[model samples]
Target: MDSEKPREIRIGNAERTTALEALGEHYTIGRLDNAEYSERVDAVTAARTRSELSELFIDLPEPTPFGPGDGSAALTPAARAASAPARIPDRREKVVRTLNLFAGGGTVLVFLLLLALGVPMAWLVFILLPMAYGAIRIWAGPGDVDASGIDSAEQQRRRDVESRRRKELGY
Candidate 1:
């Protein structure tokens, strides 16, 4: 036996469970017989120290740790997207949004005003025209407004799928 002393730091339930799972894997692969597996499982359940847990894996390779080694990684993929400050819409997108608001609200205002003045209902189409454009602009999103919208990962994925489909169709 090696003379080096194992660390005896106290272990938690999660640590014990991890050790037991490792033992189960070894047994599943025939590294441990049924009797040996049962015995080790019992020992693992009773273990209280890191040294005890470490002893169970003395003959096995260490498993990889999950997540970042340091705790300071980006909070989300969106946050990691860019280090640049918040994106501001260009003049084109601003104009489009302004026009959109004006179209929708202006249509409603004019419609109410015309209705109050008792204008014929046939003239309502003039008010509805801008409102229809506003609805279309909203449905198409800012991408259509400025042609500068960033494609999301999901959008890229869908495009790739469509491209593959087109290739398969020989188009």
Candidate 2:
């Protein structure tokens, strides 16, 4: 009996790009050093077949361009979501968001009231200031810790205090 051989699939630029991105992640997490990363990147760029790209990641971990079945690219959606970092909004973020909502609504109401009362357009500045202030506060972010100015210990202390305050206030 004659057996049929599977065809070797050639990779495209998209596959090469995916391989580079995966290699970048591995390098960022310190899995590959500078020399090894450079070598793998060169190989990925020059690689023609899916098997060539797959071989580059054989020594590495998951999140590779090639999967177990037929060199399929990328993680499953569930796996991608699971790997992503969770960003839980803290108490200060919650407060800022709430205040922004109120500020926006109040600004609109005042603007309409001024317009109905035949006030000069210049008076709109008064309605706009609170909104501007809210925008600035939101842009500045949480005030509990100054990431650049504070030492690690002080920053930790501030975070602890903020956490305690949030717990006490039921936030």
Candidate 3:
């Protein structure tokens, strides 16, 4: 009869429960510090989950030095990935077009008002008045952000909401 080498019995699921109970006892009796106890306990718990632990084997070092294989070529800066292009604004273009339409409409309305009020042809000069006023107001630059002018309550609420959104997104 041949006497062969004895095989080892791998620890099973029930053994895991006993191990955990022992680990908890060690913690409760002050045999280990909280941080060390938790780390060791987590390690044993992690060891029993086979399929989950299998992921830990990926690209693991084998106690030997290694580097990138010599066959592959490295890419230069100009050959790297490019960003997606920005689209130009159609919205602002339409706003300018609408402003032109508003100017023409204002002229027609002024002419009609003069005729209705029984004014003479010389009143046609009034047609340019609103357009000139609008040009001067626009060229004077944007108005000041005076606290007394605009209602501060709603503006404060909008700023708070924007700040909260930024914080929640972790930016």
Candidate 4:
């Protein structure tokens, strides 16, 4: 009990019992079905002090026994987490990155082959030089992914795979 609050006592046992009976009647009339009525009854029956009862009633509707009353209660958080997928590790992604890096390699090899086969200087300058530049552009060109809304976790996984391929292929 707060020492600062004014308090009064019901004068007799009859008065207290009558007050409790009246409150119970009011509760029963309030459309509290059996489950709720029983839960509140248990709370009230077990209450040892006025403060405990106050705590029990703090913004709470009558209680009900725990059950799958709603669909939410049926599934656990761990089940939700497990159902959500982890990122797919892209095994074939390395092949695309390798293709990008080596798209230029073929042009280089062809130009070299042409040069060794005594292709004329005028043809090499007009054809091979432009082709070599095009190859470099392809190698160092813009990436497949644009600088847009890439999910970072997936991007990191893809980058890791591409880097592994680069190392393996001695790029």
- Judging by lDDT against the true structure, name the best candidate: 2
Worst 10 residues of 2 by lDDT: 143-152
Better of 1 and 4 by lDDT: 1
Alpha-carbon TM-score of each model against the true structure = 0.32, 0.39, 0.24, 0.22
* TM-score for candidate 4: 0.22
Q: Is candidate 1 or candidate 4 better by TM-score?
A: 1
lDDT of 2 by residue, 4-72 (tens): 875679988788877877776655544565588778877887899988898887655566886555333
> Residues 1-171, candidate 4, lDDT per residue (tens digit)?
699985632133333232234334323333233465446545544555444344433332222111123123344667644433343424334445555565566557766777888876634554655565567656564544423223456455545543453344333
lDDT of each: 0.54, 0.65, 0.43, 0.44
Compose the digit string of candidate 3's lDDT tens values, residues 117-169. 88879465565666675675576545432222322453454445434533443
Candidate 1 per-residue C-alpha lDDT over 43-113 given as tens digits, one digit per residue, 9 for 90 to 100: 67677876565565544432201123222142354543342223567665666777777776777777778
Indicate the TM-score of model 1: 0.32
What ranges in model 1 sit over 4 Å off?
Answer: 1-7, 62-171
Predictions: Cα RMSD each: 17.6, 14.6, 21.5, 24.7
Clashes of each: 0, 0, 0, 0
Candidate 4: 10-residue stretch with minimal lDDT? 61-70
Give candidate 4 regions above 4 Å deviation.
Answer: 1-19, 59-171
